[model samples]
Target chain A: MTPKISRFFAEHRPATPCLVVDLDVVESRYQALHHNLPSARIYYAIKANPAPQILRRLTELGSSFDAASIEEIRMCLAAGATPDRISYGNTVKKVSAIREAHELGIDLFVFDSMEELAKLAEHAPGARVFCRLTVENEGADWPLSRKFGTTTTHARELMLRAATMGLRPYGLSFHVGSQQTSVTAYETAIARASALYRDLQDEGLDLQMLNLGGGFPARYREDVPTIGQFCTAISQALTEHFHNDLPDILVEPGRYMVGEAGVVSSEVVLVSRRGGAPTDPRWVYLDIGRFGGLAETEGEAIRYTFRTPHDESDPDHSPCVLAGPSCDGVDIMYEKARIPLPNSLRDGDRVDILATGAYVSTYCSTGFNGFPPLAEHYI
Target chain B: MTPKISRFFAEHRPATPCLVVDLDVVESRYQALHHNLPSARIYYAIKANPAPQILRRLTELGSSFDAASIEEIRMCLAAGATPDRISYGNTVKKVSAIREAHELGIDLFVFDSMEELAKLAEHAPGARVFCRLTVENEGADWPLSRKFGTTTTHARELMLRAATMGLRPYGLSFHVGSQQTSVTAYETAIARASALYRDLQDEGLDLQMLNLGGGFPARYREDVPTIGQFCTAISQALTEHFHNDLPDILVEPGRYMVGEAGVVSSEVVLVSRRGGAPTDPRWVYLDIGRFGGLAETEGEAIRYTFRTPHDESDPDHSPCVLAGPSCDGVDIMYEKARIPLPNSLRDGDRVDILATGAYVSTYCSTGFNGFPPLAEHYI
Candidate 1:
């Protein structure tokens, strides 16, 4: 039987080397997340892939937005998301951006240090703020303890300073890290935030919100936990901390909401022999690269499946290395993957790389080397 | 003493996160290569950032273009480079690209296989063809021997087939590898090409050009060999192979032409405590990341100098890890590097990343997580 992907390809016939989003999957994922994490307010991380369609769907699903820049704020607004629903989440923001956010009626901003608070106080004195606390988790896949975020001591100082400056310090926020494999990291971050929240309350400042910044991993590989499992962990953590009575819980999920809903379709322009020694193996170069379909899989090797047109019976799978159109050797998508292809696979063949939605389109350097991205399509 | 880069930043006030090009250094580097290798024709590989100003300057300096796609071909043309001076050097030829090349009057193209030859023959019969021969270099930074070129045996067959198809097989081309630190690798590739050139003549075929594809390293650190040293080796190799008489030489240099010319200027957005057992180390997070200024430094650690605004003297330097605005922990630029800055460096201070022109701009994922490139300005 022909695969569902093949049928989608037949109907859409997207431009080669282009990103395609399945709106059905996107809506289903959004609905599922909302159903599971009913207490937590979802803020679509606009940085993932702020394509209009994806933004529209998320906003339509009643999700707020997490924007990092003026342009991202503009994109969210253009997609009909209100300024009140959009949080300018960059820890260190420019003065101009602070002014712009104020003018746009954007109330919420993230501050990691006293200097940033000073800037915010001078620029947007009345803006509602979230003290971004630095959660130190060395065991997590990404250790965010070294980057942007305030320590517990620093977080208290910043929160107190915001109150002293006549600004509304709404709550606390912390991100575990992107593509976090461990669910315990979220629980630990929430536990830390809970302690910070209580300490700030003890200092006589009533906080209204606690942002558990999104690092909820989408199931890129089979071994990755499902979104249901992730939501359950968050639920358990929330129950332990607030005992089912919490401030407005916020999550800035970028990849989990949209990553698996997208696919990149590219045509095989040429299938030719790449020379190698008898001992060393060869590669089959494709039209996409680290710049295109495989931006997320940088540093490590990944596997992707492919097949030829017409002869679609999982054509004798073989481990072939796939490279992009660029001359750079590092411009590879898969280091090695057992892709199904016909023995006579030649020019004009097509391949669909599954689950490319989140960062692929948004991160593409289309103007690089003068190669613009192929037009994107949504279904 | 003030650095040469100070002037460029003066005119374009080091926008928090942007790329700056020093044209004086770029032109001098261009002239140095031309002065060293008079007999060899130089083609600037536009795949490494194809910025309009850079292209225009290189073209003005009498450098032909090595374009991989029709888009690059068009960019070169728009930059005032004539089509005859552009070589469509990608081995994988698309039918539309072949037709576009023909329409644009681009005569030179490369192919590694007979299948590609047949397609090109059908699309553009009168196109001047070159067969890319695989150069076996055991010791190179990145071995292209396995990916792009055809084997010498297969190359000969492809050349013969091109002759039969009524296509003019003009020359042979091979890339040893990108970032080739060894000078001997070029000689090895030349020696291989020399054998092929001799065999083609012996077979009664007229070959007019011998393309030695570019892998010339731009000196990032002090240890890299000078351009004059590389040219001396190439000069000696040509003298030994052709006895002072050889085909018109073609060298495609991408990084060497523009790497040192560009600098990415970014601001220190946040500095947090990191990577220590509660005693010492801390990582500084900048506005740039693996996605921005450091995209070219893939797989290897990069050391870049950062200076405070307008204050070069008595710079306070410290080793710190840098990260981009993304929440991903892996979105790091320098995992660790000593950056020079004044104690006044707060949230708003700017830092300049030197030698970023080569592959940084071209390889970036612009919309990744909805972050667009920092506005770019050419001085």
Candidate 2:
């Protein structure tokens, strides 16, 4: 456990099923990213953890905002983010919201489809818009399907269309997917962006920026390189691809900044064996579930490393099936995680879920089966 | 399309990505339940679309409530439901919430665990509690796992223990799961409850009630028997199994009472055919997604019926992948639903998602990627 996490719990004694975010760690991560990637301007994607406290802290540290919705834009503004510092990053936005964002003086936006481009042209004329270049990325925990970006050929056509429609075809943006671990993915995505930048320039439309969209991996149950390592790979790739004289580069890093900064402390609501046998994975239910946060566990794709008060080194420790405290049977954490849970484990035992700062609260359903969303405690 | 649905849209023309709940249908469904299942007292499960207007309409029709959390219980009370008329239906609850419910004069609650029983025995001394019986319910779209219940032998021991702890072991309960199509599932679950009831009575502890927990079906993409057919099967089984002096039967119908009463009108945000072929699944993106409202589509478990303006007989139509308007890839609704769509369908085209009253708004995430939770429009 980190010192801030230990000290925060010791001082506050916050209730179980609460998310404790260590701002000190968030600052340290930000500092590391700033030091390593000096060329790239960071736009903290607010959807990762749009908590006002996190926003204010990131704002103070001079982080710009990548807002997906008007609500997030409002949140960023509340944290003192100006329109220029905030980009309407979501391409799949309501046409009405386009006008609203334009009215709010948010000029920079991302658009992929002809429909979105038309909406942008009609509503937010002369606005700076980036075309998303689709890249098939592997090794990402959540492989963002081919939903947002487009093929290079299609992207070229869209950028040309954007220029013709009186909108500034500003730049090229690409996302390799969420929790992207492989440094090679960034190198590949940057290379693709470089090729697109050169292609657009060849057509007389000078793409001003290269938006290196987020996929920065956070340390969870998986092994991922540190921010410095990721930055080193990225810096090298940028130097090689851009040939030293680089245009304005931007990154919307969501998970990397906040994922490790927050931890969720949940309570074991029930400890029961499904069947009579000791070998049967002991069914452990926590007070928190997908609706109460930890939604990344949808389909058991991403498993956050956990710390139980019980010692697994004990001989009695065994594999267990974990579930959330809800009437819904789908509220399961794991079918089987071979960890040393105390044989005498009972209700109310604390289970600390680590590295949950990204997409936890924002993904939480309003209230499902009476289970309220996870309460956040920022220290 | 239902007549009321058309009238609702014609009269109001509510914005896309909105929930339109028709009170007339809710009242009509209630009337049918009252007529068919006369012996069973109905409790509207608040977790299924906890809109205040729906609650008030149900309350005005003399319907009781089944609340999952303290917040739900408070909503019921605020909507004019008496404390005695509301049952704390969720088996998994916090000890503090149990205390809060007891303090609020919620006399009835459900418990399945010894840990919860102990908490209840201390917090709410004389509260009437029901022990849930585990059943393997077949033909249920959402099959409830054994996470909330125990076997007959275990439940008997729990009820006996409840009596010893100075709490009223008032009844036995079992759920056949949500969207249960086969009436046989109810019959089988009822038989299990009857056997448990008899065993408890023979042990010198008389059970006062039988909670035939929710599993009632809603009209979706699949074929399901009418409410009358389900009630007949349940009624026959109850009459045969109880022998004489039938206990006060309670049915917590959440989806059944409201599912068909509401419709979600979402705009087609984008239409993209991923592969360059007519056979490729046409990808249609909507303004709302899993995070917005259609969370029952988690794993595509509950496929709600959809109404598009395009003609199915058109030779140009093809199989489609329906997705929500979000940056996340998982916001997809259908990977391959062979629904005919106009190949020319573009952004802002309205698609009516039917029979979505239950588990729609309550299951929606707060807001993801700037798409706000489904706005409720009560007509």
Candidate 3:
């Protein structure tokens, strides 16, 4: 937990199953990214956490936004971000959403398929559009390959078609995937996108941007590459591929900016051995689970580290099946990971799930099994 | 689609990505379950769809409720259900929830472990408690066995312990699983529970109820056994085990009660061949996805059939990967299933996902990706 969150919890004693985000951490992360990648324009992916507080902070920091829906564009506007700084980032958008975004003055939009390109041409005529390229998400914890992007050949045809259809084929974009751990994944994607950028430029399309879509990692149970390391690799790749003729670099960072800034403070609801066998792992139920904003825990992909009041007092730990306090069986967060929690853990003991700022609160079910959405506390 | 829902859509032309529930189907389902299982008292699991309209209707039909949390209990009460008609069904709960339920005059509770029994004893003193038994979920589409319940031996000990902890050992309960297709699973669970019941009875504890917890299936992509078949199987099992000394049967039906009663009407956002290969399956993006409320589609576990305007008009069909309109890759619902949709399906075409009344609306993320929670309408 950050010092801010720790101090807030000590003084306030807020209710359990709440997320506490340290705005200081968010600002520092933004500074670190900006400092390291000086040439890149950072677009805060608001889908990660669209809290007005965070948006306002990023807006004041001069950070642009990449919105998945028009609701997000409205949120950015509410946060004082100009429509020009907001990019309609999602490739799959309704015609109405396209028209709405265009009317709202958001000029930049993304598309991968021909149908979406057509929608953009008709609904937001003459708008700047970027075609997303299908790239292998080899090193991402959560692969985003199959459902998005298009083959290079398809993207080329779509971009050429976009210009003919009176749309500005302004750039190319690709996501390595979310929670991407390897810097080489960025290197690989850059190489692929740069080659395509040259091809599109040769084909007479004035591609002004190389969109490095969000796949930034957050520290969870394991440490990840520092922002500097990722930036160094990214910078080196840009130099090797662009030969000093670099396009305007745009990096969308969702998980990285606010991920390490928050902690989910949940109380243990129950601790027991379901089978009553000595060999069985103890089941520890928390007030929060998958539906309670830990949706990233699906398939045990993003393993979050935990902090308990007994962490120091009771040093001994044992394997436990961690689950949310829901009646549904699939609500389990980490059974396969077999998280080793402190042996002294008891019902009502506060367990802090660290690095949960981004993508946690927003993914919460409205009230699954009568458990309300994860409460937010921005410190 | 139900006649009522079809009529509603035809008349209103409600916005895309909304849920329309036919109240008539919910009532007919209640009547069917009641008529088929005369011995079983229906406890409509409010966690499935806690819409006040359904709750009030069920309340008027004299249906009891199995609430997963205090909020659900409060909702049931708000719908005019008496405290006596509600049972706190989740085994994992906070002490605050226990105290609140007790204060609300809820007398019946379910538990699977010692820690929970103690909480009930301390907070809801002298409340009737039922032990949940861990049973094999052999034929369930969404197996719910591992996260809940305990072994028969453990349950026996827990019930015996409940009596000493100032609680009544009311009965035993078991969930075969959700969307369970086999009637034999209920038979097997009943046999196991009855054996434990007799053993506990010999030890001088009177168990008066047997909760055959919810697992009742809703028709999805495939047909499931009718309510009459499951009731017949359960009746035979109870007769064989109890030998005319039958206890009060309690059945909690979450999915069956309303699963088939609702339809999610969504518009096709985009449809494309991403790979640009003739052999490649088309990707169909809908306005609503897993985050929007079709959470049961996770793991492709609950395969919902769809109806499109082009279904008949186009005549020709081709395999397609159905996905939600989220930038996230995991938002893709049915790639493995390769649902065959109309070849002529185009963007903005209305597609109706059927049998989604239960468990769909409640699991929707508040606004993941800035897409608002699935709107609901009752006809």
DockQ of each: 0.43, 0.49, 0.88
- Candidate 2, residues A1-379, lDDT tens digits: the string is 5798988887887887888899888888788888989888899988888888999999999999999887788889899988899999887777777888899999999987777888899999999999888886797889884677777877888898899999999999999888888889989988888987888899999788999899888888767888888889988898899887798989889899999999999888767653434554577778888778777888787788878776664456666777887667788777755445677677777888889888887788878875667788888
Please state the CAPRI-style docking class of candidate 2.
Answer: medium
- TM-score of every candidate's chain A: 0.89, 0.96, 0.99
Name the lDDT value of residue A242 in candidate 1: 81
Which 10-residue window of candidate 2 chain A scores lowest in summed lDDT?
Answer: A272-281
> TM-scores, in order shown?
0.88, 0.93, 0.99
List ranges where model 3 is wrong by over 4 Å.
none
Q: Which ten residues in a row have the lowest lDDT in candidate 1 chain A?
A: A273-282
lDDT of 1 by residue, A239-335 (tens): 8998856888999887777777777787777765454233333455667777764665564433333535545554554455666777666666666
Best by TM-score: 3
Q: How well does candidate 3 score on lDDT at residue A290?
A: 92
What TM-score number comes out for model 2? 0.93
Return whichever of 1 and 3 wins on DockQ.
3
Clashing residue pairs in candidate 2, if any? A69-B370
lDDT of each: 0.75, 0.83, 0.93
